[model samples]
Target: MTNLSLQAVKKAFGPVEVLHGIDLEIAAGEFVVFVGPSGCGKSTMLRLIAGLEEITSGTLEIGGEIANSLPPAERGIAMVFQSYALYPHMTVYDNMAFGLKISGMAKPEIDQRVRRAADMLQLTPYLDRHPKKLSGGQRQRVAIGRAVTRDPKVFLFDEPLSNLDAALRVATRIEIANLKEAMPDATMVYVTHDQVEAMTLADRIVVFNDGHIEQVGTPLELYTQPANLFVARFIGSPAMNIIPFDVLKGGDRPALLIKGVSETVVSLGPDDKICAGGTGYLGIRPEHLRVARDGDMALEGAVLVSERLGELTNIHLDIGQDDPLIIKVPGMIAPRRGEKMKVTFDRENIHLFEAEGLAV
Candidate 1:
């Protein structure tokens, strides 16, 4: 097991700086995932950790040792790229044994490592099979096995499942998770744009935006108590519904008026505070909104579209806002187009963001 630390790390190309100062600590044997949109510097950070890119400033420590000057092979780290990068002509066994062979390891030791990795990855049955004979998921497993046979202290995966189809991706993801469980002492850092992957596989997730860290927390922490508007919108599927409003009364129990919805004065809980006459945003998840009962505070809107997705239905409503407010309902539902509907949410489920986009 190995721990990693990045102190004031920065990366730049020419005069263009992409990664702002980033400081993070990854514990030994912990699985940390970096997630963000494209061009967000997540991959660049991974490359820096793998010694594939030079850091313009700051320090990188691997296993309590300064590793900025170390070469990739000397860093005791193995990287699995998005592409499998397997040799087409070599069988699974030979491919896995290639690196150990080149390193002049004893024949018996090489065979033992290869067989052990193959069994761990469920690739033992296909050891003699060529890459062409393996499915996409199997080939990806072979790539992982090759890395495992090297006995690296740290493992870096750069969107390893992106190349596979949806079903194959899910299968490969499970395999990777199992591999982590089997090798509990191996430190891992994974980069992906898929939140599902980050949520399911990581012990902790680091959310990045542009070139800076947004927030770092467990999946549920990030989902439930986002640090700001960016994370609140980005972390959830279907995205949180944000409705702009003007603060009517300030203090512990502030009141807000929805910008587009007239005559609606929403009173926030005591924990929510905002200055008077300032703008604020209300964020609610689709699943949190429900059909309004009598005498409940509600926002009325006309149904724009309803998508029936097996287990649940996502109904888009036009409530005079720029974007349609979505409500997720259980089971099959086919609301009529332009049908007027009233929805309300609980006070605890509401997220209040100040004008500066910070959560109150």
Candidate 2:
């Protein structure tokens, strides 16, 4: 079935543990992406699944078989590494056929597979060209072609597009997405640091942090309803704004007090567990804040920087916080540098983080 399952999977190198008791499942044919910052163990988890690294404890199963002890080749999996790892001396055709030839596949069958894979990756024209003669995207496609020749039940991609330029990255991402469509039954696991890649390519994204999974959900779920402060800050561009504020006691409802040029108190969730007079963080995305209107909760700040990008503008505001608050205004609006302004956010869009950064 090519489904993968991990039962309390843990990995260690000598005395140091990287992945800690991770439990997950991937349905057959699902395109799952592991995403996180560098050193967050996303790649480590991918390596473990690929059998490139051993699991120090627990079990790993692929297609309903115990595969923890299986060598990578025996596990019916193929990996495309970050570095092309191609033999510069060999032509694309030879590179794609090398593994099949070594495995004693008939020349006719190897040729058939290579040609079909090349056609799928649109690398048919470059089949006779050597690695050094091909562009970055062509070389990557050749690598993918080599993997396809193996006819693996599972495919593992470790940041395959990171080495490409911006244009090539986009083109190759579309290629990978199309590849998944072409081979719907082949399970693929991709690891990347780019959230856009995770959002676009993944059926489900596993967000990793500090050697643990912070959250697992579709892109929209993670964007709209982050589980904790770490995820709220990590998933979005310019990040969600975090401002610490105090709560007032002896009120019918809780209120968040934001202090800028003026102190402003805004009402919070009626059912939240946060006690009155306690302190917590108020979280809002840059796109959520708007120019203050009459009777709106306003915080005064001066623009530190305004970045106009044709259709949208990003402004950095110094609101007496540890970090400058960023506000994103759509279309043709640039507040001048050092211009004082008042920004307000809809209460419904605000997020509350209680003590220990737990979302309320």
Candidate 3:
């Protein structure tokens, strides 16, 4: 296992900078997943780490040694790409052993490594099969097994399951999780646009946006206490419901006025920077909103749509806002379209953001 570090890592294409002074330290044996929207530099950063792209500036270190000048082969890193680039004519065993063979490893050692990787990936039975004869998931496993046979210090995955079907993706995701457990000492870095994979598989999730590291934390930390608006909306499913509001009063507890809706006071921490007569957004998760009881502060709206997804229902309400306020109700409670409803969220669950989009 190797500890990786990037200090002020910056990448540019001539004059246009893609990554701006990125500094991160990844612990040995940690499974870190980089997640963001497309063209956000997550993939570029991965490529830089894999030595596929040269860093414009800054230092990159692997195992406490400078690796910025090293080629991919000498970096002690193995990469598994999104596409299963397996050799069609070659058997799985040969494909897995190809790298070792090219490195002039003895036949006995190459055979041992191939067999070990195949067993670890549950591909032992299909070792003799060609890529065309195997299923999509099996092909992907063969690709991963090829990398595993190298016994690399760092394992890098770039959207390794993006090509698989939904069921295959899930199954492969589980396999990856188990692989992490089995190879406890191997440092793994994965890049994915899928938040579910990032949340479930990462020891720590790195949220990237617009070529910047928006936030880096445990999955629950980023979900529960987002640093800013970008992260608040990016990490969750269905996203957090954000409503523009006028601040009537401020302090530890701030009163906000949602025009044409309702006035409510929400709790804020002592360090939260908010002021009276300011404008900002009030963020509430869908699951946080519930049917309001008497005397509770609520937003009245007409139900525009409701989705009954087995155990929970997602209710979209037209609350005289540009975007509908979404509420998640327990069980299958389907409300008729245009039906009036009042929803209230717990004060503790509400998030406050400044007009500049920074969390208050």
Question: How high is each candidate's TM-score?
Answer: 0.96, 0.95, 0.94
Clash pairs for candidate 2: none
Clash counts per candidate, in order, are 0, 0, 0
**How do the residues 179-243 of candidate 3 rate in per-residue lDDT, one tens digit apiece?**
89889999999998787899999999998998889999999998999988999999887889998
Would you list the C-alpha lDDT of every candidate in the order shown?
0.91, 0.88, 0.89
Point to the candidate with the largest TM-score: 1
For model 2, the superposed segments whose C-alpha errors exceed 4 Å read 269-277
| Candidate 3's TM-score | 0.94
Candidate number with the higher TM-score (1 or 3): 1
lDDT of 1 by residue, 85-165 (tens): 899999999999999999999999999999999999999899999999999999999999999999999999999999999
* Residue ranges of candidate 1 with Cα displaced over 4 Å: 250-253, 275-277
| lDDT, ranked from best to worst | 1, 3, 2
Best by the lDDT measure: 1
